[model samples]
Target: MYKCFLEIGFEAELSTHEDPELLELAHEMCNEDVATRHIACAELRDMIYERGECNPYRMDDVFLLRFLRARDFIVPKAHRLLVRWCNFRIQYPYLYEGVDLWALVKIKDAYEGTLLDRPDIGRLSIFRFGTWDTSEFPVEDLVKAGVLMFDIGIRQPKLQVLGGTLIVDLEGITLRHVATLTPTIAYQIVSLLGVTTPARLKSCHIINYSWILNTFFYLFKRFIPREFYDKIFFHGYDLKSLQKHIDLECLPPRYGGTCNSHAPFGLWLQKIKKYRTAEFDKEMKALGYLVKE
Candidate 1:
């Protein structure tokens, strides 16, 4: 599958060869000093235990490291993030319950395809809001599936280290589609991506926007974090403008790039299934995911 499934969390040192740049990133952005990282992990663990409120959370070094890195190794912020994540779990357990990636993919409205190439930034996932049909697929189901993708993605060290990028193609957005994102749903999305998620969101590219999309953002922009807002780019149907941030080489021909073509949805499902190892399933189970045997 991937060179290695998510590495088992323990006392292992960072590998020099996997992605040497990550060591630099860890130190520079995460304030990670190899000597003191364990101290931070332990401190975060102690903070979680001391509060005695967050349930079904992992205190392992690697698990704690994800939150720490996302918050720049600030122990208190990391603890806060970890607690918010735990509360999100308790608050919306349905999001994690029995996520059938196979079934989710079949919902035409909720199509998510992986970009075949993994860029230095991280793995890329593209979503077409245009494909969503509110009449058939409930918005909550879309959120349920989206959360599963995030949960799976954050477990991988490569994604955790390099972070992830998203391309949102809003080619056919309409008032009907915009209506699906109510204020509460919009707030949850903003909070999940901007804060609660342990995964680092390197960037989000919004392309092929229309006035409807603009109006929706106007109404809900306040819900988004300022820093996260800065990372979002509105390309407005200009793939060339998008090219400035993401190399054309990484995009597909549909977006004016030189990738052969997108893989079939079923193909991506097969690949994702490879990631569901015994250990991975166990961790997800502890987090209340209904992992099918």
Candidate 2:
């Protein structure tokens, strides 16, 4: 039913549904062949059990498929990712434990970070550090909110296959803000997304950056993988430079684009709420996260 994504350079029409064309694309790009996929999932489950992990992980095909796709269907690599992710959860309980889906309204209300209304090659999310008030909202709370966002966003199969893009707008970033991102926080943030998370990040656009933000990136640079490092583009307040990758019309008005109307972060959260399944709640509860009824 989705006709637009057939061409090579065409932007994918974002939908919760993954049509046949996307499946074919996954097979071509992500090595998701039909026959081997079943075997790979089974093997990954076995590998996890062999590790003698005490934590309860969702070992079903649906949950396991994300790691497999993230690592290009390599079972061993997928297995490693699963283990690292489980370990990451144990390492950082503050980010996950007692996190309430509704309680994050304050962070979303800040509108510091959100996905744009339109979809480019992948879903375009903007994180505006300029809007963040560190005094009111601790950097740790932002990290907690980010973890929640990732957990929710990763449930979409379309996002898993097509990947996503991030725009980190560093306008008005002060030294104080940079100070908040200490080496430990930097390492945790980098390791959480880069090392453990199964989500595919197509590219990261750094716009509205300054020397202060440069210091932060310098700290973040070491933890970034070489492959991921190549995907980082520094626009440094050049909207035109950003437009080269993201079309002018597709961008919101803040970034010098024609699209004026945009969905607020809370609205997007409401829309994605349906993607949260009973199984998700169970997993969260197992990890000592309180999922309110």
Candidate with the greatest TM-score versus the true structure: 2
Per-residue error for 150 in candidate 1, Å, reads: 0.6
Model 1 root mean square deviation, Cα atoms: 5.0
* Full-model lDDT for every candidate: 0.68, 0.71
Question: Per-residue lDDT for 1-293 in model 2, tens only?
Answer: 22322221122222346678768877976789866788989988888888765343577887888899889999888877787888888788889788776666666533333233223456666776667778877888777777776776676676777677777878778888888988878877777464788877777898877668658888999888888877889988788899898876657788887653344555555544544567667765765666776
TM for candidate 2 is 0.84
Clashes by residue pair, model 1 = 208-237
Question: Once superposed on the true structure, which residue ranges of model 2 sit more than 4 Å away at CA?
Answer: 1-18, 51-56, 109-120, 259-261, 270-287
Candidate 1 lDDT at 54 equals 78
Question: Per-residue alpha-carbon lDDT of model 1 for 1-293, expressed as tens digits?
Answer: 33232222111112113356667766865677877889999898888889876754567887888898888889999888888888877777777766655566654434454444353546566777677777877888777766766776576565566676778788888888887788767766666564787877888888888777767676568777787877898898888898888776667778887654343343444555544556766776776666664
Of candidate 2, the 10-residue stretch with the lowest lDDT total is 5-14
Worst 10 residues of 1 by lDDT: 7-16
Best by lDDT: 2
Number of clashing residue pairs, candidate 2: 0
